[model samples]
Target: MTTQTYLVSGMSCGHCETAVRSELGAVPGVQQVEVSAATGRLTVTTDGSVDDATVIAAVDEAGYQAQRG
Candidate 1:
């Protein structure tokens, strides 16, 4: 497994957090996600094949921006 952290912007509430989480969760390799809007961070655990672009795209679809840490 691989663990990655990302900084996300534009998340402001619980609904936003859930949206982002759900989006990421739908990805095939994603196993866990922790989002902290107050700190603008997201931590993800997934299988090694998943790349940062895939995670970022998921965040974008959920209405936010993300970059790998």
Candidate 2:
């Protein structure tokens, strides 16, 4: 498994966390997703290699921004 952490922006509530989690969870190879709106942090666990672009795009789809940390 691979674990990655990202710094996300514009997350201010539980709903934001949910959106980020749902989007990241949809990514191929993603096994788990953890997000904290308070901290604006996102962590993803995957069964295989997952690219930063994919994760960033997922966050964008969730109506937020993210960058690998």
Candidate 3:
């Protein structure tokens, strides 16, 4: 599996974190997702190379900004 971290912005509460998690968790090959509002960090585990654009799109869909860390 591959694990990666992202820096996400605009997550101000648990709901925001949940939304981001839900979006990322639904991506194909994603096995785990952890979003931290306190530090604007997102850690994801997947079975293969996940497209960076796809991850960005997921965060965008959740109403947040994200970039690879």
Candidate 4:
């Protein structure tokens, strides 16, 4: 398994966290997702290697911006 942490922007509430989490969780190979709006942190656990671009796209689809941390 692989765990990656990302810094996300424009997350200010629980709804933001949920949106980010839902999107990240949908990525292929993602096993788990944890997002914190208060801290602007997103943690993703995957079964194997997952591309950074894939995660960034997921965050974009969720209406936020993110980068690998």
Candidate 5:
């Protein structure tokens, strides 16, 4: 398993976490998504190589911006 963490911006509430989680959870190979809106952090666990760009794009689709940390 591989785990990646990203610093997300513009998340301010539980809805933000839910939106981000939903989008990331749909990505191929993504096994889990953990997000904290208050901290603006997103952590994803995957079973294999999932491109960072893909993850970032998923976050964007959720209406936010993120960069791998």
Candidate 6:
């Protein structure tokens, strides 16, 4: 498995985490999504290499911004 962590902004609660997770979880090859609003971090585990742009796009769709850290 491959894991990537991104720094996400504008997340302040569980709802925010859920939104991010839901969006990221939909991405192909993603096996798991773990997000923390308090830490402003989003971690994704995938079976293979997942494009950074795609990950960021998913975060954007969740109403937040993210960049690999």
Candidate 1 lands at a TM-score of 0.96
Model number with the top TM-score: 5
The digit string of per-residue lDDT tens for model 5 on 1-69 reads 999999999999999999999999999999999999999989999997798999999999999999988
User: For each candidate, what is the lDDT?
Assistant: 0.94, 0.92, 0.92, 0.91, 0.95, 0.93
Ranking by lDDT: 5, 1, 6, 3, 2, 4
Candidate 5's C-alpha runs over 4 A off are none
Candidates ranked, most accurate by TM-score first: 5, 1, 6, 2, 3, 4
Tens digit of per-residue lDDT, candidate 4, span 4-62: 99999999999999999888887789999989998898999998778889999999999
Candidate 1 lDDT, 1-69, residue by residue in tens: 999999999999889899999999999999999998888899999987789999999999999999986
Candidate 3 lDDT: 0.92
51, model 1: CA deviation in Å? 0.1
Clashing pairs in 2: none
lDDT of 2 by residue, 1-69 (tens): 999999999999999999999988888899999999989889999986888899999999999999998
lDDT of 1 at 32: 96
* Per-prediction tally of clashes: 0, 0, 0, 0, 0, 0
Which residue runs does candidate 6 get wrong by more than 4 Å?
A: none
Quote the lDDT for 48 in model 6: 78
lDDT of 3 by residue, 1-69 (tens): 988899999999999999999998889988899899999999988887787788889999999999999
Query: CA lDDT of 7 in candidate 1?
Result: 97
Cα RMSD (angstroms) for every candidate in the order listed: 0.6, 0.7, 0.8, 0.8, 0.6, 0.7
8: Cα error in model 3, Å: 0.3
